[model samples]
Target chain A: MSKGPFKLERAGLLQLLQALKTQGYLTLGPTVREGAIVYDELHRLEDLPIGYTDHQEGGSYRLEQRGDGAMFGYNVGPHSWKRFMHPPILRLFRARQANGDLEFESEGEAAPKYAFIGVRACELQAIRVQDRVFLGGPYQDPHYKARREQVFIVAVNCTQAGHTCFCASVESGPRAQTGFDLALTEVVDGEHSYFVGEVGSEAGARLLDRVAHRAAQEAEWNQALALVDRAARQMRHLDTQGLKERLYQSLEHPRWQVVANRCLSCGNCTQVCPTCFCTSVEDHTDLAGQVAERTRRWDSCFTADFSYLHGGSVRVSTLARYRQWLTHKLASWQDQFGLLGCVGCGRCITWCPVGIDLTEEVAAMNDVQTGRFAPKEAGGAHV
Target chain B: MVSLPSPIVVDPMRPRPFRVARVMRETADVVTLELEAQTGPPLRFQPGQFTMLYVFGVGEVPISISGDPQKPERLVHTIRKVGAVTEALCNLRKGAVVGVRGPFGSHWPLEQARGHDVVMVAGGIGLPPLRPAIYHLLHHRQDYGRVYLLYGARTPRDLLFPEELKRWQYTLSHAPGATPVRVTVDRAEGDWDGAVGLVTSLIAPLTIDPSRTTALMVGPEVMMRFTIAELRKRGIPEENLYLSMERNMKCAVGFCGHCQLGPHFVCRDGPVLAFPQVRDWMTRKEV
Candidate 1:
């Protein structure tokens, strides 16, 4: 069928992997290593973590074995797709003198073709957010553009939700809506195990022909829809209506001080976040001071030097730093980028050293007694 | 599986080479470098715009383009030796090569204030960025009404471009609708003959109608705040006043996120912004 809801046997995953490698692609998928589900090169079907699942919450993550042995049954992990698209450290250029004049050689043309498998819907939304930042902006980042152009995406519909998952509340996920070549819903019941594959693009339909698949029946389509509905109901929720205004009014609230006391400013949250794209430029010279290279690395807003002006750093107080990070993530980002920075994947909550749950913190600031914040007029009003 | 042309192929981070044609010492710690592009078209800049000057082996710093806008061949940057990158910029010789990016950020709105009186205020090293606007007003002297300059420095020795200031004062004296150059020193020494007080003192005695005037201010944050308060008292609306703000600008574009103030990035939205746009942000500390 042109628009297929096709059924593939659970064991046909090996055929799909081989088809990808038959073409010129490096297939990357989820696997268990070092206690977390991380993406790595997949040379064979056994590379996937079958029968394994995970439980994630604020400052905690644990692996658990499932009875049915599903290959994809978990939510997002601490590592995001940006680690490959927009690298942590990118060399912008190299400069050297030529006949008493300087010339800059750009190092942004070469990139490997990658096929990402088992991507969650929220993670795909996060990639879209980064595309808006790095590619949709006025000046495009060539390095990110090069790495992003050749990647194929295979999205996985959630069959389960983590304790920290809130993608439904943010209008990002539980199922993939767009920006994918192919999407899959893995269904396993008492005596049945199979995957319902849906083609999102021409490439996907063409690739589906290579794998062993048949047209899905009406029952199988309804089963996939029920799985999506159940996953949506299982996740946590946050009321994001009027959140920007609430954060603006609570900038000076005393709860900031309470949170600052617990924040270590270790920047682990930004490092793990899929949508945070701030960076710092560093310059280094050769030992003889002949060649100079400029590289950009990941940077965090919680650091003291992030807002340094002439005299000193603006966010010197911990209260100011924490407020900057949280407000930028939840509020001012809308004003700047016309979208919320958080995709609601909850990596920040799961990776924080003290388990600082932003949802709870935002709820605390919204409450009357704990936050001690008073609402302003209907429109935005300055204090 | 996926093969498509890149959505965007432009790299905005690369810096072009510009050789230092001349260097003039303005003060003990400050120097102005006149540069010429070694290749490509000449860089175009307007008043209140700045460029990121990168030393060969050192880092880069954002310095205002202080030259006349019409002369695109020659670029001028007046820098003070404050930090590592700035110190490296100050140590450059005549033929030294440096990387140049941008003429970034918003420019002063001089064309909008054509029929109204214009006031220029400067303090310490802030005068360089405002000098281009002054040049524009004088070149098109018939397009505007009366013009006045109010400048203040820490002391007589700390003043920059003394010869140019004297020439401008002379021109203003000879021109029609002449006004005295209101220069002040915070603490005068060595037989100083100018007014001795903060720059705010000069605003009280101006005869121009406040309702039909535009003010362009560039100085320390405290000084700009006090000057704006005095202008507000005289019935000048916040929209009529423009000021320049400074932060650690790593990229002249908006990508780096270092120079963000609230929702706006100073490097992209402005180093120069209208007073009403930044009034609430200026009031909040550590914003």
Candidate 2:
């Protein structure tokens, strides 16, 4: 492998996939499935969403033809790499009763080594945020730690930004900075298509050596950087100046009630989000009551039962539930993990059925805070 | 290839089994169960820490340890039948087995409160969690100044450990370094002769040095809030006051995200927290 930035032609991309598979990694990448691009098992280059780019906005997503034959042309979709890392459902342990005595056994499935082919910069930061939640504490989550440690990241720098894309505003994306094994910038000029590859780890350099590649010229590297910069300029902005402090002070700011009026409480935003990581457990028993198993599944704060105690749910009204989710993501997460929960991926904005864009909501709150908009009468009853 | 750290072998979710040795009914809806481990050593826990008690076919709930900390051989828990899990736990008889994953969260800062007058305020079922701390103070009676226990319940019949309360109020009050006990009720009944009002009413008559007093309280959120206000008016600094909090907890190790009170996980960061640390949060509703 060359020392600096190297160039790989369209055919070399297939060779890179082959090299990763030969090294005993399960290659996962983007593919068109059910009219949406999602991450699935990839065995060949044709398995990618070639010549397809996504058009995204609040409450809408569509796949369109790029016509330029670019393989990695799309922004992020509804699925994230967390589906493979943390998993949506997991069996925690099992217990069996015999002779009035119970025996317990842990579900000890071995973690798999995965080569993630198309990780975005914001998604990478989301993975880091989850790492802090699961591994940074004194008691580590064994299930999360095992899979997270074995992941091989292959990050892709964005050349085209979707309408809802705001990673540039959060300082988390458009260009892959760190937390990746290998970073790629796809360069398509008229009839020529190639990837500008930069090795980030020893493993990435070893894989690059197996694929045929040449040192990139000065002009080619400059063109790659210019494309990412253009993508950065195309993104929408989210003003985060003192946002955490502002949200904490605005717990009863009435904007929550306004949003709750439109929100159906369907929880689609949490399902599509890359950084929301709350879970609840359920216990199951057999018909004879001999065997019992406990399973953990992803849980959303939108549900009233999420905060249920002995008597009843704490946040009974939709207004309180929405306030908890938003404040926890924007304000309280900083106090808990020392970092913002959102990476500005915009998946939540695009997938929300009512098109409740968080960036717009924050701007509205700022309008009231700065006295740009008149405050409504404080008569809205909250449970 | 990058080398990663090996996974920790101990799983925090697994619960050990314990057999019920004796069950004593404290009230019509509350019971105290003494448990002995089915296997392994006994559970050693500090005062104010809680355990995740699990019924075989039912579910699990967080219950604070109510026994003496020094007497770890017999694990004791006082439970009120509030939900399905607690109902099943209260019905448990001798020789019945249950699961327990335990001894989690912050404890009362008794060590830091040394040499200061200790005042404990408990309401309803909250006294069980504070009972262990009272036992600790009595065992090490020489380490503290004046000790007082102010307790209240819904009614006289609802009071727990009736015989023990009598001994502490009558016998111990005459002993050196005595722990004076004051009892109150929300409403009076037939043949009742005691103060009848909210527990905060009992705080006015206590002769305590606010500067040197350490107040520990446990009760419902509204009760704690009012008690905190009364304690503050008495000139007790916020840092010297402690309160035990309650929230819906699934994972006691802080992974479930169900027990979050603002940024703090009540299962891990507390069951007991300083008044100043949660002063701003307690004022907000449904946080």
Candidate topping TM-score: 2
Say which candidate scores most in lDDT. 2
Over A1-383, each residue of candidate 2 has an lDDT whose tens digit, in order, gives 34698898978888889888888899999999999999999989889888899999899999999887788899999999988887899988887788878667878789888999989999989998888888777677888877787888889899989899999888898898988888999987654579997888877888888889998999989999999999999988898888887787677688888999999888888888888888898888999998888898988888888899878887778888888888788888998898888898999899998888999888778766643223221112122
After superposition, which runs of candidate 1 have C-alpha atoms over 4 Å from their true positions?
A190-192, A369-383, B1-9, B172-177
Error of 2 at A331 (Å): 1.2
Error of 1 at A191 (Å): 9.9
TM-score of each: 0.94, 0.95
Q: Which TM-score value belongs to model 1?
A: 0.94
lDDT for A349 (candidate 2): 91
Candidate 1, B-chain TM: 0.94
- Candidate 1 per-residue lDDT, tens place, A1-383, comes to 37768888865767888888898888999988999999899888678877778889889998888876677878877788888988899888999876787889888457877889988889988988887777765667778777787788888899888999899999998889888888999997643467887888887877888888888999998999899889899877777998888887787777888998999899999999998888988999998777899999999888888988677897788788788788888888888888888888988999999998899889888785324344321113322
**lDDT per residue as tens, model 2, B1-287:** 34445534368888888989999999999999998899999999999999998887677899999999999989999999999889999999998888888889999999998898888999999999999998998888778877788898999999999899987774435355544888899989988898789888888787788999999999877788888778888898879999999988998988888888888889989999998777656666677
User: In model 2, where do residues sit more than 4 Å from their true spots?
Assistant: A190-192, A370-383, B1-9, B170-179
Q: What is the lDDT of residue A280 in candidate 1?
A: 89
| Each candidate: RMSD | 3.2, 3.2
